[model samples]
Target: MKNSTLGPPDSEAHELQRNLSNRHIQLIAIGGAIGTGLFMGSGKTISLAGPSIIFVYMIIGFMLFFVMRAMGELLLSNLKYKSFIDFSADLLGPWAGFFTGWTYWFCWIVTGIADVIAISAYSQFWFPDIPQWLPALSCVGLLLSLNLLTVKMFGELEFWFAMIKIVAICALVCTGLYMVVAAYQSPAGDVASLANLWNDGGMFPHGAMGFFAGFQIAIFAFAGIELVGTTAAETKNPERNLPRAINSIPLRIIVFYVFALIAIMAVTPWRDVVANKSPFVELFVLAGLPAAAGIINFVVLTSAASSANSGVFSTSRMLYGLAVDGDAPGKFKALSSRAVPSNGLIFSCVCLSAGALVIYLVPNMLDAFTLITTVSAILFMCVWSMILLSYLAYRKQREHLHRASKYRMPGGIFMSWACLVFFVAMLALLALEEDTRKALVFVPVWFVILGLAYRSMRQKKSEGVQLSYDAD
Candidate 1:
């Protein structure tokens, strides 16, 4: 918001000042890019692709990097880009904006539920006797309160949350590297080598099917990559800091996923990397490190909590935005004294509390988590499609942008089309797969709900206009 504005601008023009510092923006980007999916699901991926899983992550990372670059370009072009939804609506038309904004809200809301399940389930690993619902409820309560603070406070919280995750992963990579070197001449008599990668019945031990199955698990690892774009509204230096963060996507994938996975595989063969356990903590134990399980558990707990915090933050902001646009109850847009979207935050958190109830009813959390994750992934796809549509629209209407499109997605229009095709294929694949098929059913239901909500909002708007005209 400009200093000249007497108070906040009109709700539609309600700008999020670039108050987030460089460090906060960088860490927030990382925090969003990494999630519980990496630590909890990595072992499952290892089982699917053996050591070849690293290659799967690399491929996904390359594609996602291009996507982020495209988003960064559009956001950079317009200082008024409140969020991706604003850009989407302004460029891709009203339908695109409505779908994108609501779908993103669903993405985080579902993801938050999944994180709650993980948090409760992980807590059981430490305290097996405790009721799962108890921890889930408690965590939901804690993070809900934390997120009801100012946006700057939220940014600072994410900063530390991302820092912890970064430190944990880097330490794991470094420790794994050391273990591999040490294992070469150790008494176990297994010379630590890249050969270990193939020792478990070769790289494609499970064959072509296994490689394809890699996507099943690998997709979860890339769950939050789009999260970087969500923070554009809050970044301190959107032009400078965002480019710095977006450019690092490729490097992070290489360093954290590819090289780190290689280091772990070199030390321990795929056969020994137990599919049911965490590959991260398992590496520490393999290296003969003490208390590795506890350490990893702490990191995962904080990771889950951090994500929940963000879920509350993003969903609230989106809802508040919608409310201002007359798409939701006017009450939701009201700010607390701290300038926090307190009402919206509470609303989303209360919805997230449903996880605790579900856990109480169902013995297994995995089924619920999987279904929600699929829908969340689909929602994220919708958000991405909106982004591409926005970019495409912006290119046609705005002539100046054409002269300076250096960072255009590779293959230009072709890659955009390719990505859309890939997303459609992904949806089809979800139906083909047992775990993700539920979203095929659920996503359509979500659109129906959104359609009804839009109609109701339109009715309300028309009535308001009529009342004003009568008074005039």
Candidate 2:
């Protein structure tokens, strides 16, 4: 509503509108970063690192904090830069933009499917007799409809989506504190203690293997952390709001992750949780609540739906930016009557529709989920690596720009090198994990494909320039 724009130049003169406020940006970052993965897949994280999983998340959080700072500083450099890829290009090169933009787009598409699939699975909690395909289809139709209304509507929806997560997490932390430090013993078991986190099998219960193992899975939970940066163009006060989102989002994620994982492990012990099931849900059951499964089931289902909602919003926004930049199909560049990039929103929803087919068509559910996560992580790694590389290039090639920056990165290239190394190490860690190895395979293949695509686009541009010169 507040940030709508007029029609695409190619379309009937129109406007594009989006009603995202600074409040919305903060919550979107909160909601997007704290995904269903932490709620559902955290069980696996607990199983891997045991209690040490908490430490793993903190470590990754620190690395990504620096990543966000780099992104924020880059975004602040130019108010007109709508797309992160634009900044990537300005900072690094056209190749960086080409790779980062497309890869980031690809990552969300994969992540969106996972969210949709998870949404359908969550729906099964309340409707055991209903077919999975129906709910998945219904969800796709529903979110698509909501996004089409207006940009403000999208922001409003995200606000609620984020509110749900924030509320649930706060409640969980309060309840867990009552149970742990308050020493309130539930009917089902012994009282909890902070000691449970360290004393049960010790802090490093799973040993170095488990400690390393947690990194492979934990990184994926942090996938949407950059959503705040993506919204710089849309925000009314990028200088103020974007920095606020970047500063607070990481700390919130770390708290949510470390506390929630600690609570789950304290109640059930890492060994007691089902490898395939959600540990968040199990914490309620362990607390001896009669409605544990249903309550948590509802919460996680909402979590998945919330994730889908965000994936659609961000992907469409990215497409809208690329379209405006001549990086994507021009039609997708068109604005809505409401000033939102309605065309790109529709395009992303069409892709999301494929989730319905997957509801019933997969060969195996876990296998399909694993493939999706692997690809998402690989693509995300590529996008993140580009950001770091772009920052590195920016510092060296644009010394004047760096000195001119009001929000220059501290230690400058020093932090840039650390972040890049961290990104590469994450890719390597993905390769080492049996659970995440396919990600390694998919990522390089993606780079090669992007390379070819970039080359083709360059050649076309060269021809276009030559033809224009001849005409002149």
Task: Name the candidate that leads on TM-score.
Answer: 2
**The 10-residue segment with the lowest total lDDT in model 2:** 1-10
lDDT of each: 0.75, 0.75
Tens digit per residue, CA lDDT, model 1, 313-423:
888877766665555677876777676778888988898888887677766766766666677777777777777767777767885885575545555566677777776
Q: Alpha-carbon error at 457 in model 2, in Å?
A: 2.3
TM-score of 1: 0.92
* Candidate 1 ranges beyond 4 A from true positions: 1-15, 184-191, 404-411, 470-472
Span of 10 residues, lowest total lDDT, candidate 1? 1-10
Q: Give the TM-scores of the predictions, in the order they appear.
A: 0.92, 0.92
Q: What lDDT tens digits, residue by residue, belong to model 2 across residues 1-472? A: 0011222344465534335788888888888678767876787778878888888889888887787888888778767666577777666666666677778877887888888778777787889798777877687778888888777777788888778877777777767777776675645565677777777679898788788877765777888888877776667777888888888855796568887777766666566667679876666666667897887788887787887887788888888766655667778767766677778778888888787776567846566676677778667767777777777776777778778887766666787788778877777777777758865776778778888988898798789889999999
